[model samples]
Target: MKREIFVVADNIFTPLGKTTAENFENLKQGKSAIKQHHNAALSRQPFYAALFDKKEFPKEDRYTKFEQIVIASITDALQQSGLNTSDEKTVFILSSTKGNIGLLETETHTPELFDRISLSASAKLIAEYFGFKNQPIVVSNACISGVVAIITGMRLLRTGQYENAVIAGADVISEFILSGFESFQALSPGVCKPFDKDRDGLNLGEGAGTIILSSNPKYAGNIKALGGGISNDANHISGPSRTGKELSLAIDQAMKDADLSIGDISFISAHGTATSYNDEMEANAIALSGLESVPLNSLKANYGHTLGAAGLIESIVSVQSLKDHVVLPTMGFEERGVTRSVNVAKSIAASSKPNFLKTASGFGGCNAAIVFGK
Candidate 1:
């Protein structure tokens, strides 16, 4: 028998707000955190993205901007859960594509600074900072990093490996990352409009999100992690599967693992990056799963493509929606664009359902889906 895993507490730090409540409230009003930027080092052309206020962080040479974001989110989540970070039974997991890659621009750095560039090195630093007795674990699976981290935590808790798992994911927008996306001509010049006929490309954003999972009911509060499934189409490195059948399989398996059917899900938090290939692929996948009528929303317009933080941050908002019986609108969506039909929410609506699904896809053909319930 598997142990029940529940998300006891979560937090999000984004440009729209520092706390989850603040971010959700802003979303209710259909406000977007994405904006334009013209950083010379990042791009010669103008770019739009959602970014947190760097001035808010304390001046410290000991930690990188990425580490600071993770610390802030994890600290808030731990405080809310009242979990002992120093406990031997607690585990710390960090999810990200690039940790301190921005440090490479510096001409000279101490051995310690150089070491921090490695994802594992940064994870260990954060673990020691929190006094975690176990070695830190790092997940660097591109955009699916956050969702995969949550799934990893669920498995560990079910095995009784830890009493609590602190999962934090973050990716800062830097020249290293921005240039890569630009090379592919994937960055949008304006705020993203997922599922819209006028949608062009994705906007890169940065933020941190954390979720604390445990088997104890006290920490579970009102929501539980039913099950999660991950798959890869091996179709393309940057492009998604053309068939959408690959992602549908993952969704089907996730629902089955949760002992759920198509009718059980209330709403879907789709991995809608506002890209042409991505939106169409997801619509076909959802339709293939026989969920074309179920209301769904994409949060990219609110926070752009947050990369590693996308899954957890969007999932946190979904939890808030489930708790309040309100479904937030998919900001900037105007008209249908995909070949397959999908019920993309155009405005705020009320829902009475108790369960929701969160899904994401990423580079290297990775796809993941998870079910959560009250």
Candidate 2:
């Protein structure tokens, strides 16, 4: 039989809060981190996003903002897990679409700093800082990077390659990313409204999130990572699949891997990027998986589209909801948007179910689904 993998500890550093608990509290209170920004470097027009303050993170000349947040998040998670980062059996994984990419524009004075622009370089730097024995693994897959990272760690642990895996993901909002999204007209003029008929586009955000998965059940707090699956639409580089068929396959496979059924999932933590295609695509996928009635909420409404950190942070919140037996509302959602009807959580509600599903789809038509249970 495959080894069991459990999520022992996790933390998130975002504009919402510094710790997982703080972020959850703010979420429960219906607070969102998204706001309008006037930074000329980020955008010529006022853009909506969730950004952490400079003072909120340390200023280290050797570390970029991305590195600082990743280190901070993973350190807290490792501390809470009581796992030694230096342990030989502990592996580190970094997930991000853009790691220290901003260094390209700002570090021109130090041409050598150009090397830091590589994702692998940033991961190695972090691994060295924490004294990790293994070479750090970096996952740069579009938006699904976080979930893919977790799935990667789970598979590694199942092979007995590692006893503990520290998976962390983060992506900072930069002028390059902002301009790219603007070019696609994918940026919302205000806070995104997932699954709402009036929803237009997504708001970009930045944050770091870390989740520690271990083979030891003793470290399992209230949730375990049961099974997950990943698939690509191979339809578009930047657009999602026209039909939700590809993503539906991922959801179905994850359920089968976990020995679960539609009735077993009490809620769904959807990607809910609020873009016309993404929301509709996810709706069709959920319906195809026969989970149309499962109550669902999108963290995007609370955190905006955090890109790399989206999956990890959103999964952490889903675990919190399962533990608390409460379903957080789909913030900013007022009307149905997709063709396939879904039970979008309009208000906070109590639930006794023990299992939840988290699904994410990103650029390049990548889709991932992970099943978790308390």
Candidate 3:
């Protein structure tokens, strides 16, 4: 028999709120953290984003902002799960596109600073802090890093290498991130509108999310990591596939792995980045998967695009939706924008659905899909 993986506990630490319950309540009330900012250190031009107050997260000499948020999120999750990290079967996985990349903005880069920039180095520090028995794993595969981390943890548990996996992902807004998005002209002028005709670009956000999974059925909640699939189009370094066939392939594989059909999925948590190409590509992929009518929503407008944390934070929200028996509306979505038809959620609705498909696409033509269910 296949080892069943259950989501034991989860946490969402964002500008909207710290706990998953708080964040879900805010989403239910249609509140958003995105707003205009004039921080010169981040960007010369004004931009919109969901950012944490500097006062709340002071510059720590011991840990960087990236590391701090990850620890905070994982700590919350671990507390909720009541799992002992010192157990030999417990493992840690960290996901981020830019781990301490902001350290590069310093005037003088020392060897110690250089070492701090390594993702594995940060992961090790976090693991040591919690006295984890095994070396931590790092996942930094563009924006899909979080989903990949979850899949990695799930596979590890199935292999009997670990009984419990503490998966956490985080990325903070910095000058390095803002400049890169500005170079691509992907930064939205105001709040982003995913899958909307008027949508122009994306907004960046900073946050951390953690989910704990265990092979033990005693840890089971209403949701579990049914299955996941990942693929790369190899089309462009910074662009996604044009036809969406590659992403469809991934979706197909995930469904196959989960032993599910289109009818089994009640809703979709789309990677609606609100960019011209990404939203269109996702719609095309959904249509190719014969899921054009499935209700879908993008949380990007509420928290902005959270980069490495996007997949985890979004997945956490989807899991919460399943628990609450509600489908969240896609904030800032108006009329449909993509060429292919897709059901963009416009308002909160009650649902008794037991399963949902969460999809994500990122630069480097990478895409991921995972099915979570009762």
Q: Each candidate: what lDDT?
A: 0.88, 0.91, 0.92
lDDT comparison, 1 vs 3, better candidate: 3
Global Cα lDDT for candidate 2: 0.91
Clashes of each: 0, 0, 0
How many clashes (backbone atoms < 3 Å, residues ≥3 apart in a chain or on different chains) does model 3 have? 0
Clash pairs, model 1 backbone: none
- For residues 313-355, write the lDDT of model 2, one tens digit per residue: 9999989889899988999999999999999999999999999
After TM-score superposition, the amount by which residue 133's alpha carbon in candidate 1 deviates from its true location, in angstroms, is 1.2
Models, CA RMSD each: 1.5, 1.4, 0.9
Answer with 1 or 2, whichever has the higher TM-score.
2
Reference-based TM-score of each model:
0.97, 0.97, 0.98
The lDDT of model 1 is: 0.88
- Model 3 TM: 0.98
